[model samples]
Target: MSAPSTVLVTGGAGFIGSHACAELLDHGYELIVVDDYSNSAPQVFARVQRVAGRFVGAVYELDIRDRQALSAVFDRHTVDAVVHFAGLKSVGASTRRPAEYYDTNVGGTTALLRTMHEHGVHQLVFSSSCSIYGEAGALPLDESVPARPTGPYASSTWTCEGILADVCRHRPEYTVVCLRCFNAVGAHPSGLLGENPRGTPDNLMPFLAQVAVGRRDRLQVFGDDYPTPDGTAVRDYIHVMDTVDAHRVALDHLADGPGMRVYNLGAGRGSSVFDVVRSFSRACGRPLPYEIAPRRPGDVATLVADASAVARDWGWRPSRGLDDMCEDAWRFQRLNPYGYEGSARRPGADRRSDGGPPIR
Candidate 1:
């Protein structure tokens, strides 16, 4: 039999990336995980191995922007495809450091794509965000919706999409699927791996989980004066597992032919901030304390998904609900209050600080 297809997963030790690694392994794909652990803990790989019940083919603590290093990985391993998830993903942080966002998100993607072209590995599934669709012109934002990204993070993502589209236009051999994901919440059902943001959590679910577990004093509700019924922002919160599954399906689609496509991955539903708080309260067995604050800059009133395109094309649908998201996330938080650090024997240990030189 031919060898199992080896998929190189950038940021493989990260939140969604780790889950994707497990799912890929379960589906019988060989994995080469590359992570710098800049915003992730090293122990996540161990947890991922536990979940997958097997050893990953290789693990490189390298940044994707390191073209020489990334090329080395391509040379050493026969990477059939890449699930590109290596980039900074924080709206507030991106706003603070626009240059970093552009350099890492756009520049890193350029480096990876260049190396892929050199190695003749042409299939890619990119981790894009719904943030690319700024204030949507219509509800249930679909793939056709024009992207008017607001902040640096969204702009970088849009730029990366453009880069991929251009590559596909010229190189018909490159198969690229940009999965524009909605708010990715929840942990794996095993509770072994989950969202573990560094410093303070940026997203809703992790922040709420921290509040429920008393990591923070209380939750800070961003705003409560929007036009929605609850007057808070509304979002299509998709379970992280569902989001990872979309990657699998997209990779499968690539086998058919070389082309560039974009699909919104969401639950096709919206829930207000208050709804999430209420749901988490039920999950935590008590109401979580929060104080409303001024609206965050670049905040939108409502952002849901019209994921019919992905569903119709790939036969993918979100099976988990809001409650399922809350319960699993809470379980992860409760199990490890300090995220991976809480249980990690060597909390900050890394094999190498700099990614080192590319392997010969």
Candidate 2:
């Protein structure tokens, strides 16, 4: 198999996509980014620009659903592979808007694959999720675990895996790698980019950041009565940089023609709500304010990764620790106080661009 000389990153302006774009750039891969700005900002392009050290890639404000637009970008760029990160990913939002979730996550992937086929682009690296293993009745989850997606968000990811499988089976020339990512926390070391959840964050790290930034009142410790060492739910919180590192390895797997593979990208460790809060406190040198509330509906007791597969297959491992995750998240939150609401910070506040607040 030949190396992927050029690449296309879908949803490249959003949180994960943006970081992946920077990683790809550092590796000297020619890049083309596609995003609709539905949940990000145009300023992200500038951020990626800084990460790249030059304006070498193109950014198209196009949605994946628009096949013509996607095809046009492919026609304009000589793309050798695709890293698909374009999809709706909120669990609660997915329940409220199931059809939209299916359309964007599942339908958009179908469209992207068709466009890739028409454009003669065969290699792909998909961003899957551990949510597919809804209630992992066990401690560590491996790639062979049965998927039981409890919500539309998880269902959508599983559906895409099935789509890729069918696409690969039908086209012998096509190659694909699906990465099942655990909870991705933390920010880039440069602090130039990070997880930018638009609305009130649903994840733990963002919520902690909000408390640290004084945007929210206090952290709500959900379900303190769970059957665990801490009596609260524990999760495998892998750093975003580590997740990006796995993407690098997955891309290499495809570039090196290792055939189709699925790997769980994680730290192989667990951090409870209290553990995260303590880490943040240590990182910022301030105790995070919090309250213990009933476990939110559908909360899992314990969910961590059996990261042995990826480590064995690609020789990859997470380098960042929990404290590192806290520090980076704090940096991003400290840099952007308002959480990209696009509202002015305050009377006579400084604004970066006339572009306005971030879109959710």
Candidate 3:
């Protein structure tokens, strides 16, 4: 039998990485998932496999910063391209630990690039963030807008973007596409794989899910006095399905072009915090317990996307609405009351977090 065509996915065990892995498998592309399991668990691979229903490729417990280790994987498999998703992403945490964020996010990306160059794998799809826009003066932020990342997390993303741009400029053979994604929320419809943050979550959706499942007390409505409609902050929340689909589109786009490019992936519509809370209440069959709180540092009033370039160039558009996001998230919360831990506790399954939820 012939070896399957493979693509390397760094951080494939993480939330967005796992979804991208499932999407790639559905399209018949074999995968090589590389993860450090620092913020994610090895058991996620089993859940992804169950959702995929077949083994696609290898899962290497490796970090991107370790060039020799990453090179070893490249030596073993024919990696056509890489969907780079490994990085430290918490904004608040990055504020407290900027040096670690720079070392991991920036240093790790440089290592990955060097290894890819050594292995002659040039094509790459980088996971950038819309926070690169900082506080956009315009309503809908476009690709042409200048990026001024206020925090270390966003700064690291911007730094990597510059590095990839320079690499692609010098190495004409390299093909790169940086996707600047906005809020990535919701869960897979199957409720088999979803966003499972370690410890307490800092993001809104994960925090909201905890509250819905009785893990947390209430949602914090940050700044109900902002000058937006309903006096709340507004943000572009893209569904995980749509976010993964954009990744596929970016991969395909790289195949057509052999140079560096960037596109914003988002719903192109901003929803207020109140809007999200109301939607969550409607989806979960109960009112969300929320209280108005002062806005946190570095938060902007409204940040939506202009998405025309991605749609025009890659023929991609976000299909799911706010309602779909809330519904899928509510479903996942209801089914997996204790997240993946709930599945692990069933008879015949190991309760340990390291092992796959023993195939119940």
Candidate 4:
């Protein structure tokens, strides 16, 4: 499999997925994207087109679990590979709605795998999470550590990876790369594309951005009495661009052989919640208001990545820092305070997509 030319990107309307769509298009890969817009918006492809200066091959608004719709996408497009990003990702929501998470994450993955098998597409890049690691272990977590998934979200990701591994084992032609991503933050840097999650955001940076834009009054710092220097839970926040780059690189690496591989995709550094708040404040040109609160249950002290393996193997490592991430995120928020629905409409696009070939 010499670098795949056509890729089907699930969840292409969401934050990281949308950025990845633009990146893949920039690299001259045709994309067939699908997203239900549950947590995302449809107007993102306009910004994606603005960024890439090229339209997507096709865009389908449907659930990945729909074998007919998924197969229809494969049937219509010459999909050489698949980039799986469609699923419920909120850790808190996953716990509250474990059944929904399993049904969407686990069930959707199975549906996707079966559809791919039907189409004879054996190369896949799965979007997994470092949350599956559960807690900090040996300072910076590595791939060698045994998975100890805690919540439903992490457990679902762990299960998906297991299923992918089984697929590779049973089917010799399968080549899969499961990227256990850390906190993926930042915007497109163009100020045109960024995260705009529906309802209240479940992630820290987006919530902080919302507050900075006056959509919310103040942020609630989870804890300020942790063992770390900042006395707050720490996480490895990798830029969305770097994370997308790793996906493209991983897709190329699959050309090496037919086997299942796992890599920790992160910045190999940790930043506390306070650190992000302070940096976000700098980006917004003001100190964002905040109040310390009790530590949320199941929160960890540190969740940095030992990303040396990916660096050594694919020559991939995050290039953007916290300041860069915050600056871009703030730019997107500042440009569109009310998110996608309320943001200024692009020149040739309204609330809907940018006129790609529809699924129907």
Cα lDDT, model 3, residue 284: 91
lDDT of 4: 0.88
Q: Least accurate stretch of 10 residues (summed lDDT) in model 1?
A: 345-354
- Candidate 4 residues 159-240, lDDT tens each? 9998999989999999999999999998988888888888898889999999999999889888888789878888999999
Local lDDT at 156 for model 3: 91
Task: Give candidate 4 misplaced runs (Cα > 4 Å).
Answer: 342-360
lDDT of 1 by residue, 1-360 (tens): 122278999998899999999999888899888888788876787788898897777888777888887787787788888999999999888988999999999999999999999998888999999999998679889999999898999999999999999999998888888999999999998889999888888888899999999989788889999999989999999999999988887778877677898899999999999999999999989999999989877778889999999889877899999999999999999988888864333433234323544342
Give the TM-score (vs. native) of candidate 2. 0.92
Order of models, best lDDT first = 4, 1, 3, 2
| lDDT, each prediction | 0.87, 0.82, 0.84, 0.88
Clashing pairs in 3: none
Count of clashes, each model: 0, 1, 0, 0
Clashes of 3: 0
Across 1-360, the per-residue lDDT of candidate 3 in tens digits comes to 122257899989898999899888888888988877777777777788788776647777766887877777788778888999999988778888899999999999999999999988888999999988987688699999998788889899899999999998888989998999999999999998888888878788888988998999998877888889899989999999999988976777776767899999899999998889889889998998988888776677888999999889867799999999999998988887777763332223212233323211
RMSD vs true structure, all candidates: 2.8, 4.7, 4.8, 3.1
| Residue 150 local lDDT, model 1 | 88
